[model samples]
Target: MAHAQDASLVARDDIPKTFDDVIPGGQDFTRKEVMIPMRDGTKLFTVIIIPKGAKDAPMILTRTPYNAGERAGNPKAMTIGDAVPLADAAFVEAGYIRVYQDVRGKYGSEGKYIMMYPPRGPLNPTKTDETTDGWDTIDWLVKHIPESNGRVGMIGSSYEGETVAMALLDPHPALKAAVPESPMIDTYMGDDWFHYGAFRQMMLGYVHMQTVQKGAGAVTPTDTYDKYEEYLRAGSVGDYIRSRGLEKLPFVARMMAHPAYDSFWQGQDLARLMAAKPSNVPTLWEQGLFDQEDMWGANHAWLALKAAGHAANNWLVMGPWSHSQVNGKGYNVGPFKWEGDTARFYNRQMVLPFFEQYLRDGQPAKLARVNIYNTGDDRWDAFDDWPTSCAKGCGTALTPLYLSKGASLAFDKPADAQAADTYVSDPAKPVPFLPRPVLDPFFGYGTDFAGYIPWSSWLLHDQRFVDGRSDVLTYETPVLTSAVRVQGTPKVDLRAMTTGTDGDFVVKLIDVFPPSVPSDPAMGGYQMAIAMDILRGRYRESFEHPTAIPANTPQAYAFELPNVNHVFKPGHRIMVQVQSTLFPLYDRNPQTFVPNIFNAKPGDYQPATITVLRSDSQPSAVWLPVVGKSTTP
Candidate 1:
């Protein structure tokens, strides 16, 4: 029976200490749990990890509700109860048979938790979510485990990176290969409960104070328990959702009571359910250019699997950690650092030689379809795609800098009888992603933390910690003699007009440096470093259709901005700030779109009117994709 469950988990004694000390190749292999089933009969609940007296090997799945037995165990734990176990050790010592599971309803599985996945709406040829329970747990671990070898590969990260893109839909014909780290594909554009349309609100109120007010197994520890108790569960999910009043199970109130994009997140659209065809297996994507929240679902699932011509073998690996910050062990990052052997060069050269060239015996591994990690010159570059035509640019061109009055970033443009910059977002005085009593360096647990928190120049060199906030709005762009690279995703064309009936806009792109000549005890001087992105403006014209911009008249309101490479140097200065609110990185838009603001009501609140057009015939810009020159090798 699967070789006596791998010979009674190698005569267990809790073989812990991570399979008895940092698994190099401990007793060949063994560790069980198993349950499998699926196709709606539901069972799931795996663990696997095999190899022991090998028979076939090469089966590496993951599927997680965060607890695939705490990723096989040993995710580094120093103290605070010390338990660190997480297996799948570099794809089980590069030989294979990893497994993991749990996904169905989470822990010890059975069913009924649906936190996210194909259970939000439409698409029902008759039931079962998470891609038909990942094609029935890869068709019963490729026809009943026994050292599996039917060639399969999958990995994890956030929600086990959306269960490796929901097992790349229509999967399991013996799967083949997959990776997924930092995944989401679509939690309504701007993954994980919203951003750039706002509604992330204090990391979904710290993910409902670590999942449903610390009830389901007391505050965040599922994904199969054991990320070595993340810094002693740090602020234990805002102290157990403020001691059980439950703060209304906030996931930004289920993403602002569904601002359109109905089917409640379109039935967990992981890139239109791993977009049809082109996935003949072979895929690997790991993202995090400071993961500002699931980095646009791993850049829209690596550009929709290279525009659906998939044929497997596609790879990607962005870094600077967070959201699992380069997997455990105080991964600091940013401000200018790197040396931890680049996080063990992805477990001794790209995840155990990509499971020894596709589950052993089938050798090939010449990797790198893109292996980014250039936090503006920190190093590690290798691409065949992702902006690497030497980092192509030249499309976004919107340049209007505007916003004038005091905080500047001109190209002129403002005075058409200008006035707005107001600011009074009193969702009880929010605006913190670090920037108080000096706090610059952060990377790991960002998107404002719940997971993925890495590389944070404190939202780019502290503009006076969001300029004495009234609801934020600052702009700058002076120095610079030459050097302005950028890269992609910029959009900001907002010819706005709102008196209420829906409102929000948060764009922030900063770069403005020149402060650490010994200054930077956390922003006392100049140091703005996030030359990246922040976008959010109410489903900005179709995240499934959110419509609503009447009241005062004028319209057109875009804000994309999230792909960046950075080079704006010369003297540095290219800022672009706009605001409505970023407090809690989102979730304050209550200019009125009610139904749930934790029982809102201040008379349902209202008092909005924010425009920033820039006319010359309605010119409103900020485009700038610019990349251009590159001979650097």
Candidate 2:
């Protein structure tokens, strides 16, 4: 069936125009493609863009797994731009020598490519990895490039951002500044591949994009537009990969073999690497407030570096954008639009100044250590350091919002001695994580990349589609008399029981807008999911050694959702949605425990009845970090 588009919801009138008008013509810069040799004798493809008549300028470098030299010989490629249109135009005009390189074993680069590749230890001086490759490339640029200042800086987003981090591990003497935005640090603990212990099923598409298609130059093998159906037919994750006949893809095979947080994943953890030997490089950790994939990585990396007693020169900036939108002209996500050219504002106010201070020593830095954009209030807040830093004391205490009868949420604790809510969860009929008829059918709903599934900006999509469903247990506060602001991490504490030995619990924090807002037809009574997460009941106690739940007995399952900074306006209401399954986005929990969820058989799937307890002693509530007193109307 063809996907139907709702004209009201699918309209793109709010999309901001490109800022490419500011980009200077390519005639101003000279371009050259070079093959830089690494310590292992393997050559990596790089593109250098130099401004004509410019001398002794600070050099800026970016290394990416994606093709950095896609249009190598074309004059149009001379302008050092990014995936975002005209975002790097200012840097080009500033006359910095720009360099872009393809990381080993992708596109034009030569060498084996490993996904989220770990660094070689200090003892392995002869061995080569991402760190050594970066050091070698930097060494070459400072010596060979003409009109070059000795100082250098690095910046990139997503996978490219991770490369910037890798470069910092063993920084070159000339490397002065580095910014890794929305980097992927750990696949097992958090980020990209998995969330807690639950394997992100969308990663299957990513594996296909990076391995099957890129490796063999093959087209996407599937013909169907609806990937959700395709995934369902495969029964289990292992069955899905094996059905593709992709034994040659080592990463995919390794993921299936190691279903838990084992040694295999521990070796790839970048957090450990940073803690062991933190980089002394002055760094800026930037990310979108709503970045789907690597939202937790940059934050965790900064905290780990500080805990390890690394010299404190780190700064952070989080804006109201998605992964790619961080560098784009617009900062709109779904129906929610932020005022002004937020991306350009960031470049002009924060980014450019940062590089100028560190790379060129042009000016004293005035930016704060932690800068975050509050989504609800549409304002930026500055702090000396992260909220978690004990010295800063910027974080606030978590206030519990309890679930009550009559579909209501309140701050007052449960008065009932024994009250509970129950729902039947069927694997055959799972709740859709996103609304039907996604904008792009082939790419799937709430997915970023066409080749692989990354976190999209679907969290901002209206949750009205599932609000009326019987399977979804929703609770909302009465129309708010004042604006309530929430900052930092939100936790869901559940006291519950299940008929089956294994299941899954999904919780969503929503912002319910009043009917007065006319931005879109669906804006009236729009229920936007601000934060959401899922937990596998089997892994409730431990991710490494998951134990089956005691059937028909009450148990506690608590976990923290990703951090959020938002405000609920005076007329809006706060909402909490609890459900068992989030189909397609996450694999279905069989309700029958299997040693390895990836290897479960068709017969392992079963239905279960879930009960959420609400007694005074065992109350289930969502904990929010309240920043200050509510602003009353």
Candidate 3:
């Protein structure tokens, strides 16, 4: 046996620097290319990764649209593709057989790609979905695998996470546990595309990438990868969209038309399906605080499951990593500040022990309800239950920081303020989000700095990167007297009267820090930056049913910003900004009630007055979940 220190130092010199390097204790597990036949006689292709000696071993089932071949095989140094299988490999080596199966219509599978499923209308009924297929695959795997312990656990990320949620709906008898990492809980509220009501540009961009990847048989084409590099270097989403002609994709057209949460999007909600008689199987849910893709899904799912009275058997783990950072495995930024044995805790302590106890008759009682990683003041905390308290002492504060023309922090009345700082967000010159030359991968996949520093201008060279735009309003607080620890959703209560019948509101919470001494050449100064999160808003007053705002009436707008596990330290300040448009981060709000941004002409666009009345009577403020702050700020 190799010593711990020596084992950590071991690496293959022969292999080139690639995604495969991250796989710990890599091995050629027995691979069998077989068909996972669905109940309807529809055969789904699968690749099972079994331990060297597999007889009566518990199985970890994963159903993905991303393909089983790619999961078992090796790929380049991409984000999500890299750490997925490596994280699961730990379980495989620990006497668990891994079953990776493709959904009905994906690479190597014998069906048509159903786009995003759970079906919207007549296109895909309840009978045809990844969930149904996933259930079928698990049923087959538990019975057929000679080395099966009959007890099984499911695991996945993103779309795969959706698969895990699907498995929870009327799951098989053999399925005993699940770990849905960053699951997609709802598509309408903010899972796949529409956030609040406005569309998410990065999500649509991801759809194009997935379409191309799946089209190419789920294999990373060197040409496509090179093209992606070229696109990233272009510095804008428009350039990438133009380069790929993706503006013409059906998804874009459909998204552009549907500005409200209609039935078309509601059908994709997995929470509805799993709401009743929620899965009896204990769940080990994991998510990334920085995972721009589906962190909201996990955050919301955690709440929903708890509300459903899912007691004791479930555990939730959220970290400060992106989509691919599960198991704490990655390059350069695995355990952020921690040294080695990063991936070991999640695998050895949380996941492996979880399955071992429930499936293999090992101790399972030790698993707590919540094992979350707090990033702001980096540390791990184990909670006996999810925090569901919304009382005055709940973990959040509703504080308003008024916006003024000059860059200043204020907690005063808006009427006293001389001018409101405004910036025009031209669709032609939309703020470049991800895949912009400097940080393409970060923006493209929508998985960048959701849980770290607060330097927005540093990432992009523009100082007005978020300021001076009429679309966005800025507010900040004086240096904090105490460490303001906020966990859970942040909401913005806007007091404004709009000219348009229907419109959208976008809110962002930023961690404003004082200028840093120029130790590095890249950036300097009092960087007013966004720490993590780019939460969107669509006038909640009208969701599926879009009701026009009364021509001259004040409206109260309440929408959630991204959930945070942030601590605004004593010296650092907490800031909240409100805006109507966030550009390529989200689709342009159009400011007026138009059918959709896709077909709306310039003539169709209208300028509307957005007023923020800041007074004791009509106070507009930011709501944050501070650990010890009173709800009324």
Candidate 4:
């Protein structure tokens, strides 16, 4: 007891209170856990991995709702490189500090979670938005981390990608560079939630998986071999999701409440938010040509940035990937093959080099304004601008590919006085998006990973599957004698009369492969959909306000399909297949109009006969941006 008073035995005020002080300074890398405080006094859980000899290294930060520590690496990673996620492999090997954090209200972060939280001062009552949180984290890093050179970079994919994107709104001075890949921005426009107001039925399971807990909840198994059966048996979109007991979830309940693109969704849209005050941060945007979940969020945001006059520091890198595939081996997408390992080439040749120039004090980055992996030709094409072969500056025009009698698609307007194609669209026997016995977005992440045709490559599905159906109107141009390179969003113009008050229209721009392929015979006669989209008839006048269509009256419906940069080579055919329903991919339109589709019952769905017309007065054509002299085949 007497020895307890000794100076050595006494607990000194300077003594370390944590194990972080005991970390030896001689390892290849050191991992530390911390709680980063926000302006609102909320402490977010953070994981920092500082390389062994990392002095003056620029930190690469990734903020995620997903767990940070679990994604750092395997439970038994021996080195920093091994510890790094596949997407961050190249950056970490280059001696960059890797930092990950769980967003507020998720995992270890202390706060109430709001799914798809908007910026402060809008609908958001809280002052601590992603922008504020990002600034605080960057400030803390630059001041506390002695090894860092005080420069920071941000990069992430999917929801994490949105964090990087939102940081651009009011970026920290220390944040020098950023990359947002396959970001989920506008949920209502063309992203995870809806495409032109048509609800994406595939996202029902995903919503439950993402929001059922502090972290990601368990994947709600469909409990059946075929998801189609489960959905079909559920009667309505509301019934299907309600059966899964998701009616009580906050975000889902809110989404159900707001079916139209009203103030609720407009306030949440990142694309609109970014454009209102376009950021000047040197940002590199990425989008997958066939992203299943978020096909156009990044594309729309980048275009919005350009349109808002912030084009100088803005750049884009588009690849033939499906939702974050650039982070892995990308030799091909489904049956389509690339020239080389596109993902590796992108990360090493483009991504790392681009960051090296912006994040560090080094040589100026020599990168194209837009780096696009052209799918049809399988080549990396660089341009000073995107949709380069578009209507205005390029001196080119969007040639109309008209729909004619005898089920033909031609570049010239139909000479026929009057022509019409009619089909019966039954909500009950809706056309399937892909071949049935279709499983859950089947995809394997092995080396040389080519995603499944039904899920990852559903955008590239064979059109022949739906051609023979009586509900579809098939139109095809003659075989192309010369290569026709198309490079922009194709506009679909349909003048149609429907027996029902409401309907949905689906358009597919396809390239029918030749009868045989010498290199890969399995690709023989493949009817690949180069670009496609669906527009709900209700949103014809205004996306924000929907109105029912007049039954049995010809109405003009015009909308742009997804972006395309592909070439139809010699001997291939250009085809257009028009159908009313995309099946379980999108909720049934219930040929009978309802106030809200989510509130719709089984009785609302009915059969309707749709007639597509082509004439001088009501000419229906899909305007294609053909890049060559010979517009027609």
lDDT string, candidate 3, 1-633, tens digits? 569767766664646676434445554456678997787788888987665567888988888777688776543323222323668756766777777888877788887665666542354655666757777887888778887888888888888888888778777888888888888888667665656766655454456666654444221212343322443343333334544566576665565556566766666666655655578888878876666556467767766777777765567887656664664462323223433344456776788888888888887548667776665566666766545223244443445455433545455555643243334434444443433332323233343544332212222222345564556666666667767666665666666656655555656667655455355323233333323333222345667776556644667877666656666666666666665654455555455554544444455456666665554456566655556652211
Between candidates 3 and 4, the lDDT winner: 4
TM-score for each model: 0.34, 0.89, 0.79, 0.93
lDDT for each residue of candidate 1 in 1-633, tens digit (9 for 90 to 100)? 999898998677774565535644334456678787776576878877565566777787777766667656632332211222322445555456666777766667886664665532364445777767877778777787776668787777777778677767667777777778888778666776665445553344345434552123443333312222221132222332333445455443455456556776766667765665446677778776666557678767777777776624678777666555556532444444554556557655776677677666556777778776665565676756665321124233334445455666556666556444445444334455444322112212444544332333334435655655556666666676776665545556656666676666666677756554444444324545453444434455675655555666666776556666556666666766666654444444456655333344445546565666554445455665555542111
User: Which scores greater on TM-score, model 3 or model 4?
Assistant: 4
- Candidate closest to the true structure, highest TM-score: 4
Worst 10 residues of 3 by lDDT: 453-462
lDDT of each: 0.58, 0.78, 0.60, 0.84
Which of the numbered candidates is closest to the native, going by highest lDDT?
4
Clash count, one per candidate? 52, 0, 15, 1
Model 2 regions more than 4 Å off: 1-26, 71-74, 77-85, 121-126, 213-219, 388-395, 437-455, 518-521, 631-633
Which tens-of-lDDT digit does each residue in 233-276 have in candidate 2? 77887787778775458887788888787877776677677778
User: Best to worst by TM-score, what's the order?
Assistant: 4, 2, 3, 1
Report the C-alpha lDDT of model 4 over 1-633, residue by residue, as the tens digit. 567667665566666676433334434687888999998899999998888878999899999988987866643455677787777888889989889999899988999888878888757887888888999999999999998899999988899899998898899999988899999898888888898888988777677777888976765566775666767788778887788888888888988888899999888778888899887778889998888888878888888899899889888988988888987888987778899898888888887887888888667668898888888899988888777655455556787889987888877777767778899999888888877755555222243334324466677777788888999988988888888888877888899999999999999999999989898898788998888889999998899989999999999898988888889989888989999988778988888989988878888988999999998788999988777666476
Mark the 10 consecutive residues where model 2 has the least summed lDDT: 436-445
Residue 504 displacement in candidate 4 (angstroms): 0.8
